[model samples]
Target chain A: MAQKNKLQFIILGLLNQQPLTGYDLTKAFDTEIGEFWQAQHSQIYPQLKRLEEQGYITHEITISGEKLEKKLYHITAIGQTLLGSWISDGTPDLTATKDEFILKLYFIQTNRDPRLKAMVQEQLQLHTDKLTHLQQRLATVFPTKASQTANYGHYLILQHALGREDYYVNWLNQTLSALPKR
Target chain B: MAQKNKLQFIILGLLNQQPLTGYDLTKAFDTEIGEFWQAQHSQIYPQLKRLEEQGYITHEITISGEKLEKKLYHITAIGQTLLGSWISDGTPDLTATKDEFILKLYFIQTNRDPRLKAMVQEQLQLHTDKLTHLQQRLATVFPTKASQTANYGHYLILQHALGREDYYVNWLNQTLSALPKR
Candidate 1:
């Protein structure tokens, strides 16, 4: 993996927490981590090989069931140091945001477009459902104050996700209200 | 242009408002539209060629600086109909968000990590500056209720941008306070 590919470090960080198989890493990208970053199995498998070649990680062969062999990947000591440096590094300016819904909305020209009401209604429901899902994850992931404080950085991430969804839902609701009731 | 590349519609939307040279179209991506969508000159120029080939947009030759020729593109009648249908179409589920900062923050094992303070401080300043910029544009672009109502969808987009920055700034501030001071 190139130094600029943040996914390598994201994988490293996950392995820093605990050993995981390539399959486990792929699943993480599909779920919670998918909320902020994305990776395909195609990208993950190759990246894992490179990470091991670079000596940042290693894998142990194990049998899952009858004859299925799996490699449980673990971060090395140097890998932990690199992950810390990456987490602490200054972020680049101008984060890219590719919200196609907002881009499509830019062309609507007028609020009175006949499709505006349904468009806004669809988004409102989606954002509301998303907010509920994030809230549920927060409750289940860190059920008590002690649990939350123990995983303080993770707790903060969940808070930020909740804030993002809450803000999005409110914005959609206001937008829906502003449309003419035709 | 493929039916799936939304940049074509965005270029059409900008041209539908007024004719523009390729440079002007490129500038729009670098500015206002860059807030949510992005494209490089390489991407924009090739897409413009494909769009013309597809007969969705047409251009007229214009001279600038006494000797330089430029193609001022205009959306064709077919383009307008297509843009309308596209804006009216249902957006895909799960808009992608690739927030690298938030992803990196996930690896930060504790709030007490020494770099946490600087990281939050840097983000707070960036978000604050962004909020001020959005507010200024909103005031300048739609200074009157009459103008705002005239372009209601665009006005609503500005409001949403402000709300997004407002929430991000507040979250950064809260995160800053959560850190244990050295």
Candidate 2:
């Protein structure tokens, strides 16, 4: 299947939670699933339309403004079945990481200028900021005491994000200290 | 600049060490840089052709078989200068991870079938195998006594790879234990 179909399943999964318009879906991606999965407004709208056409989703038109029409999509029973099957059948491909940061690190020896240290510092700060934000979300979004099966996935994902951010910070620190002093 | 340009610089950087054909470059990516940077032959060959046209790189054609000619690319002085400038000027983008595994984990709750545990185990085993390969490379590719600046970069990159695999293992273990018994 085309990789775009994953986006379709993600949208269906999100709609299974609650009805959301295209704009709302964008916000949902930015605030919630944005950490790992992202789709542009262009991609989202088209996928939403396709899902509706396929009977996996149906939207209600609402009047948000005098001339604007808002589409609030809700998942159909078929959508739920599709999402379940997709989740069970799909496997994540373990291949190369196309991460630019890691790529930059590989080539760092080519230019050992002092500015490189500053750049590493900036990256460290970015990871630190992300770590703080994720910790906050963990506390508020999925409290430790909540043992609901639905929250289990979020809990595990949050842990992974935190682990990744911490790993970046560790690497940046090690790299900075290992760099030759100017 | 387009992201493809990054691949161009990467190829030039690799060729700075020694001359290589497109096949060698692909192998280099799969072994040395595969953990962080990856480019298929389709992308590599076109970029190499473009670099040759730009005079940043040149290729010498050699007869490989009765019916085939192989081109081995070598970096020019201009190519080295270009690579150095690109490395100094470029900064890695700090953004969301487009990791498909994390994306799958995010929605794993949608299908809480018992098989999900086995899937996580499979992922863990893959990571473990990768970690083992990276560790072996660390010993063979960059010995501890090698203090060359170039070796330093490879050493660090390998560390990052090992760190990432270890992180995956940790996350998978935590997730598995946290999951309710089937």
Candidate 3:
């Protein structure tokens, strides 16, 4: 199966923590996993529907009285069992896909356009902002719960993001010095 | 447009240098751009077909006597314009989607199984080997042609790959050190 299918298990894993409305799921992903993992509403809503169809989760119509009715989903026992199995089993051995930043840099040497250098600099700034935001968020979440087993996974992800951003900032500085003047 | 669409432009950018078969494109990607960019036969063949339909490339069928026929594609003028515009005006956004390795690590932390740690270690070794092979191939390709203008972009890609591999190795070491004893 395409690793995309693993998103199903990830959703199940999250719902295993608490029953959630679709909006609640989106909020959870943004706060918890969105630092490293992102999903579009287009991808999430369809997956939720499929999971409900497969009996992995059940949804209840929630009448909010103020807005449109919402569907809240809770993981079924089968869903928990499947998620447990997926967690225990190894992940698939798929190669990482191509990254465009590297590709643009590849063409930069040949092209030697000043715009390319600006692009790289822009990316560096964006990453720096994101990394800082993530660090702050992680600190807020982990101050008291730092040693909790559940929070450990998120801690590692934040660490990875921090490391990557530091690397990029250094690289961008070096690249700027090396770039030929327009 | 999905950044995957950019793969076609990358292919066209390379083909602008010389006409090549699908196999040649794959080899170029593996040796030169594989560090930050990757695509399988499943993706390439379909993209090539689409490019042909769009009149951006023309293919010539070569009969190799007893061997299988090869289709060598050459970028047309329209393709060159498209590629040039993509490189010049393309947004250098470095958006990356989900990563399975990180996802698996998240699951592993929850399970805390020794076998899982061992499995991650093994995967890390394989990635290291591949990175080493790619670096060697890049050295061979750019030995005397190092300072060529067009080779600059290629050099940047190699640098990204090396940096990424270093990050992965470091992560593996930290993970191993942090692993709880069985």
Best by TM-score: 1
Model 1 CA deviation exceeding 4 Å by range:
A1-3, B1-3
Tens digit per residue, CA lDDT, model 1, A1-182:
42379889989989988999989999998776888887888899999999999999999999979999999999998888888888777886756577777877776777778888888888888888989999999999989978877877778888898999899999898788877777
Output the better candidate (1/2) by TM-score. Answer: 1
DockQ of each: 0.70, 0.53, 0.49
Candidate maximizing DockQ? 1
Q: Candidate 2 has which clashing residue pairs, if any?
A: none
Q: Model 2, DockQ value?
A: 0.53
Every candidate's chain B TM-score: 0.93, 0.86, 0.75
- Candidates sorted by DockQ, best first: 1, 2, 3
How far off is residue A100 in model 3, in Å? 1.7
lDDT string for model 2 (B63-165, tens) is 8769698999999999999987776664546656666666666766633657678778878887888788888877777664544355556667788888888
Cα lDDT, model 1, residue A150: 81
Best first by TM-score, ranked: 1, 2, 3
True contacts kept of 3: 0.47
